[model samples]
Target: MNAFKPYPLRDDFTLKNRLVMAPMTTYSSQDDFHVSEEELHYYKLRSKTMGMVIIAATSINDQAQAFDKQITLKSDDYIPSMARLAKAIKEEGAKAIVQLHHGGRMNNPTLYENKEDIVSASAVPAPREGMVTPRALTEEEIHQTIEDFAQATRRSIEAGYDGVELHGANTYLLQQFFSPHSNRRTDAFGGSLTKRMHFIDMLIDRVNEVIKHDATEPFILGYRFSPEEIEDPGITLNDTLALVDMLKDKPLDYLHISLGKYDQSSMRDQTDQEPIAQKIQTVLKRKIPFIGVGKIETRESIDHALSLGYDLVASGMPILVDPNWGETIQLNQPIKTVMPDTLPKPLYDRLAKYRERFQQSGYEFPVEND
Candidate 1:
């Protein structure tokens, strides 16, 4: 349960330690969605103490963007942007991973002039009040979107990242296709459970194809997934377990189970006391390395997570607030709050606004400059 030990990935890379900086969006990119100087400085400050740093969800195409300042790899022009961030992380002694993503129905239409660009598995609105309904992707569009992810993978490889993580969690495009609540398609991409998973299956296959043909060396491929959804008729633990079974068979280097708490149980069935991550691991049966992420900041929580069979532990807010979280945990020292000067203005402002909530959740927020 030593979180500081170096762990080898299935690929050629070996993590310097088992504590990962989870992908958490700062929403601080430049106007054209390139990595800003602030982001590079942020990574440089934070990457020194982590094994792997999974960059926040980045748009694979123009239509994939969700946040105003989200990072993008939609075209070759953006390759330098990612390369700069990768250089920052790797130079600081951590494996750099870019999380490729599409927003789907969650995309804010205001970011696009053409509303039709906001598309998903079906023409359904997200299950939130006053949400905009999205256009359904045509068969050709679906095929192209799959290619978009492949192209994104190629770009990540070219950008000098050690790995690329498919962002299939958090109700994004990938999860939209898999969720019965959002997807109402009847074509080859929807219907039975297997059909619903067709998009992810093809997406993975195409990305792997790109990696095999394009990469000169072994490049890591990882998948992140939410275990369940709150919406009725939405994804359940059984569905996620089945997904885990299929993913274990894929060439993915690891599986990351996204959760709000490290040991959170089923949301769909409160009576099911077993943690959703533990269930997924049982289904995986050690076929793939699993990364468990959530409110894990202290050495005790990290050890607790490892004791539950997780191969690695990840933290988002803790790492964001304290750059030396890994070193603090390793040395059993108190985690200190970062100064406001270390964070991007927007991220700092947002955290400041939600300071109380973050503190309640056990995160140390950035403090004001003395």
Candidate 2:
């Protein structure tokens, strides 16, 4: 199938074309996970033509939190507000999917404070310097975390969202479990590939349970995973593929691939690599949808990715710069090229402040930067 000629992500779900708005963290949602007018306008402008809109990473809870303004699905109180946001997106006719995550080893003062007890597959310190060593998650905390993701997914549906994307990439909690550099556990949750995959299995199962109970359409349960970590050198494409094999039989709907652990980019030239998400589509031989992420800004690159077997194409910096990129591309209009330095200019500045806040208070920012 020609990916460029309007592809469907699943039998019951499809995009107008293949363009997907990459899920980005814009803390437009301050104290409440509710979408603000500015964020609403931002997404509405992009939804004019984008095939699908995956809302930015919303923390499941404070522990899973990434920043102060980061949108999340944590409470029943958050539901009505998010429902409004979801309804707005659906009104645009673009499917709404929210990325749910837990910040594990990567430090985010809002989610986890000086409480060094960072849970991972094991108690391994991140390869980066200056951060306190993470405390391993007790077995019970492990179970609770899985439950948190499930509950969060359920809440997302209640909020009128059509689907949920697992924030399994970017060196977050799930990604940490997949990394040998981070997951040093000896239990069933650790050790070999199968063990490492256990966490993914549980999360997927809970998400599927929610889907079945609600009897919704083939709502997306996309997996965003990195192929390897730049700092800790233990993983390879084969390792990631092994887990992919396990997921194939399960009900995973999509795999949004990107490389390099999140924190590694802070220390090395990790961002210098081409968006590895497209390579993920090439390396995996499967019918499930695949997407590429990075500095995808032009239609030609997107079409090239479609030619390369990417069922869905995602643009990050382009969306950050012009949430109306899809509409502009539809009109064949040239946009200001987003260079590496200015790609995620908005998100870039926020993370800088987030790090500063984390260092200062080891707690969450109380306002909505979203």
Candidate 3:
């Protein structure tokens, strides 16, 4: 039970195990931005066997939606559905965490009906296809976005979730603000590295303020971040190190690193050959727990990630392939690595349609009987 050991995240909360179900967008929510019955079933299937289940990146506002079926926390009207979704995970003895997100410039133009509605720290366009050039957010709008996150936190607390993870990774709004390639403003929210971090600092403060004022129980607050960016003058490893130093003293429960490989080396311009997570750990110095997520699938992979000094390991694709991953491990059963055709019809059809997209992200979603 090396990987199955209980982890104390805080004095008030402890996880049953160290294996977390990484949050992955299902694109299965209802049309009106509520959690659908299919999505609830999807979570229930995966929730029981993990220490914690992080729900997909959910929209904090209607205009911030990136996916067609993404769940929303923009208004209190959606709390009942959110509460049900949280209960589905918690009923299985897993802590439920919802990733708070805003698409920023990555938002679909048709959803807003005007490109100007899509705002970011600067007017830079995302490097991805179909992304539109965004209007730069005014200083007032930036403060408003921080309040939006605070309000979302309050709603999550009311919905009975154990924690909330800020989606500061994968080139979303938070990352956009920190990346020099995307955030070109000369205001306090951009320009220098310290300036870029202003948005995140303010966001964390506001969210913590809400948790302090409204939360009845201790609610975990986690931040997920990518360590490096590829563009010139973008987020380098040094920049990330500085960011980690700043965040280490914050009241965060954990820092989750968003990567494609657990043992991946520097993606920045640094000449050092150390693994990225190791570098981040050196900066953190155990001040906060580190949750490492990448292509962690097998028992050996989890052990290897832990060996690299990760406090917890998270899996995404493997759990999608086998919902009872931890249970199978405990029973000495072989865990499924490849997708199976015998999946519930609805889920199987949805995955089959998005098979190519998954592959593009370096995941091999092969059918078992193929």
Candidate 4:
């Protein structure tokens, strides 16, 4: 036999084929964010051959329950279903991570049952249409938010999840506080990068307090943050580095850097997309993993990124267009990507099937709020 060659993607914590399945919103959960078998099928199919499977952004706290069919790690009732999904994927020998999330000013305004007004870093109503005006969270409530994340992190461990990812990208609750356009407060939580990042800082501190004992087992504490916002200047890549430096003490397992505003103009208003991930990787000199994503498709591009020193690459459109995307790319097959929103037939069919099967059972529409 030839000299043994180490598996290219096999690391101490994960034995993936070099892809971390980017979390896509399937909206396939039933009432209370319970993962339907349909949802499990979508994820399990990814597990068949992928390196790592990160569940889509599952809302972790009650106030963050901004979408329907989005899975939850907060509810005890949801624990068994989530645990089963986790087990199903892990039994296939793939590492499983859950993306935990929240929405601040951006809570979908159409959820019929939610009466409490959306809360945020400030009390301003979202400039975008449909979002309700939000009230600023009190200091006590701020502390509660930290505890909520800790509780969710604890739940992720209890549910047998290999890791938990904080969803801090794309102008969500955390992003909103970090966005100048969304947050206009003079308080300590605003005005400066260090102050602006207080929420996430607090969240990590609380999470550490609870999970400090299990520090050895890839207890991933990764955060996805944006380097640029649509028209906002509150948080830029420069400000981001300062905050990242502040967060170094948390000793995060990964620092996922991504860009693109939350609004429609975000991707379009760009001058030149500087392949942002590489630039960020240079700034982040630590040895912790660095993950980058946004419009990833082909293997060569991903390989190029890996060669350029990105710790991991995340795929979005390619996977959405083809569930077996990674395996197909590895096998050297040509793939024709389709725009799910533009096309008439397949996209409509998938969306209808997804909604009908999910909403009829009481899953909320992600774009609509309570």
The per-model lDDT (C-alpha) reads: 0.88, 0.70, 0.86, 0.67
TM-score comparison, 3 vs 4, better candidate: 3
Backbone clash count, each prediction separately? 0, 7, 0, 5
lDDT minimum window of 10 residues, candidate 3: 336-345
State residue 203's C-alpha deviation in candidate 3, in Å: 0.4
**Cα RMSD, each candidate:** 1.6, 6.9, 2.7, 7.0
lDDT digits (tens) for residues 241-291 of candidate 2: 687777666777888866322112222334555434434444567667777
* lDDT for each residue of candidate 1 in 1-370, tens digit (9 for 90 to 100): 5789899876468899998999988889998889999989988888999999999899999789988899989999999989999999999999999999999999877888888889999988998764588999999999999999999999999999998999999999999999998888899999888888999999999999999999986789999999899998899889988888888999899999899899889888989898776787788998888999988877888888988879999988887777778898888876656467778887787778778867886656755632
User: Whole-model lDDT, candidate 3?
Assistant: 0.86
Q: Please name the candidate that would achieve the greatest TM-score relative to the true structure.
A: 1
Worst 10 residues of 2 by lDDT: 259-268
For residue 14, give model 4's deviation from the true position in Å: 3.2
Clashing pairs in 1: none
Q: Where does candidate 3 stray beyond 4 Å?
A: 269-271, 330-333, 337-350, 353-370
Model 1 collision count: 0
The local lDDT score (0 to 100) that residue 58 gets in candidate 4 is 85
Candidate 3: Cα lDDT at 370: 35
